[model samples]
Target: MAGKSGRRSENRFIRYLILFTWALFCLMPILWFLSIGLRPRIEIITPQPIYWPSFSLDAWKMIWQDWPMAKYLFNSVAAIFGSVLIDLVLAIPAAYALSRFTFRGRDDIAFYILSTRMMAPAIVAIPIFFLFRNLGLLDTIYALMLVYAAINLSIVTWIIRSYMLDIPKELEDAARTDGAGDLRILWEIIIPAVLPGIITAAVIAMIFAINEFLFTLLIASTPNAYTMSVALANFTGGSDGVIYNAIALVSFIAMVPVFIVVLAIQKHLSRGLTMGAVKG
Candidate 1:
């Protein structure tokens, strides 16, 4: 009994140590960026680096004033929300159809939808760019939103379908026996049941839309439509050299929305992912 107890304690200690190490690995860069962003440019560039620098908001002010920070932020928010909305609207019905109904070529069609994700963005960017240009969607938030929605639709549908499949069909059958139409059953029963999965899908779709740089860079050429990612990249100086502190400040600002979203939906996210995995 004593030997078993000792081994359990050792395992607990090892587990905690591993978790702590992984946490540090993830947080180290964030801490470094926060430290740099808080300090002035001189302190950041000094040969003897100051581990803890005096907090200053000058970089934040400078970047806000010099860059179209507000516009970029607004554009990012608009695009992300728009894309997530579109993804959910389109994915939910498709997922439900795929999950509940039996139709010819259903599996093949589902596979084809998922297979679109296998193509790299770069491979399709030029053709998409020319198509958008021809359609006069270049340098528009709508264009970015549309592209992001299309890019994320496949994965979101698959995830929601998995969760939908986990829900017992008996529930739907009961609703049907009671004279609830298919739309009514979906709206009243299945939707609430799979709400967590939908939240998870929306959060993931938002994250992808927010971080997507390549498509945004290609689609949005002007400051009006450029997102935070593209705006951050624009900070790459030509002759003045990279502004480390400024870059860090803007990067931190860009991360704030995503951090808030993840924190808010973290519970639903875990439950949704677990349910989806177990059910499928």
Candidate 2:
């Protein structure tokens, strides 16, 4: 018994050590960014890596005061939110129809939708730019919103459809037997059952939209439509070399929205990922 207890304790220690090591590895880059953002100009310019650096808020102050950080943040947040909203609005019904009802060319239609995403955005950017330009939507947040929504819609529908497929068909049959219509059953039964997947899909769409840089750069011809990613790029175009501290600060700030959003929805996110993973 003592030998078995000792072996179990050793195994637990090994498990914890592995987890700690992996977590540290994942966090090291963010920690490095934080250190760089807080360090003074001298410490940052030094070639040698400093183990411990003096801290200053000048980087943060410079970013907020000297740069149009607020405008960039607002544009980024609005575009992502709008895109996710549009994705959810369109995807939920489309996913339900694809998953629940049998129809002609259903699989073909789903594949066609996904195939749109398979084409590299770069290949189609010119035509899309021309279309939006003709519509006079160049350099607008709404244009970014529409572009991101179209980009994310296919994935969102597929994710929700997959989750809906996992649901037992008996629930729908029972609802039908109870005289509940399809829309009612969908709203009360299907949506509630797949809420986790919806949240997961929305979050994924938001992250993708936020990180999108190419289309944003092409569309944001002016500072008025600049996003966080574009603003960070603008910092590198300086004649006096790159501003390491400013770039670091912007990178860190860009992470804040995603971090806060994921943190706020951690329960749903973890459940969405894990709830069905260990099912019997």
Candidate 3:
């Protein structure tokens, strides 16, 4: 028993060590970005690696004052909320129906929906551009919101469906016996139980929407529609040379909302990712 306990302790220590190492590896880029973002431009561009940098706020000031950062932030936040709302509203019903009911061509329909994700976005980018252009939605926040929602719809549905499938059918049967309708059951029982999964799906949708650059680049021509992701490009070009510090600031700005969201819902998110991983 003593030897077994020792082995278990050693294994647990090694597992935590690996996890810590991996987490640090993933966080290195963000740390480096912070390091570069807080420093003077001279230190950022210097060939030699400096152990420490003199903190400077010139880049922060330039972005907040000189650039229309508020507009970019508004556009980004609005688009994320809109797209995620649309994704949830649309995906929830599809996931519930697919998870709880069976009908002709149901499998085919689910497959078709999932297969949309397999289609490369680049192939449809031009067509989508022309479609938005024809609809006069180009250079509008609505265009980005719609595009982001569309891109994430299938995955969101599938993710929610997986979680729903994990729910015991007996629960629904019991509810039905007590005069519960589909909508009532979904709202009262299933949704509450699967809240974590839904949050996870929303997080996923927000992540894609926030980080999307290609569609925004093609559809949103101006700053009013383009978000923080594209705003980084403005720092990389023109005769003044690359604004490395500005780029770092933009990267940090883009990451903050997502980071905050993930941190706030980390408990649910951890459960959502693991407990929601069963078959659909």
Q: Local distance difference test, per candidate?
A: 0.90, 0.91, 0.92
The predicted structure with the larger lDDT, 1 or 3, is 3
Compute the lDDT for candidate 1: 0.90
Query: How far off is residue 176 in model 1, in Å?
Result: 0.4
Which is the winner by TM-score between candidate 1 and candidate 2? Answer: 2
List model 1 lDDT by residue over 1-280, tens digit each: 9999999999999999999999999999888888898888889778985767888988888888888899999999899999999999999999999999999999998999999999988999999999999999999999999999999999999988888988998999999999999899989999999999999989889888888999999999899799998988876777757888988878888888888888988988888877766753
Backbone clash count, each prediction separately: 0, 0, 0
**Which lDDT value does model 1 have at 51?**
62
Question: In model 3, where is the ten-residue run with the lowest total lDDT?
Answer: 271-280
236, model 2: CA deviation in Å?
A: 0.7
RMSD after Cα superposition, model 2? 1.8
Question: What's every prediction's RMSD, in angstroms?
Answer: 2.8, 1.8, 2.8
User: What's the residue-level lDDT of 246 in candidate 2?
Assistant: 84
- Candidate 1 local Cα displacement, residue 174, angstroms: 0.6
> In model 3, which regions exceed 4 Å deviation?
1-24, 278-280
| Model 2 stretches with alpha carbons more than 4 Å out | 1-11, 275-280
Pairs clashing within candidate 1? none
> Against the true structure, candidate 2 has what lDDT?
0.91
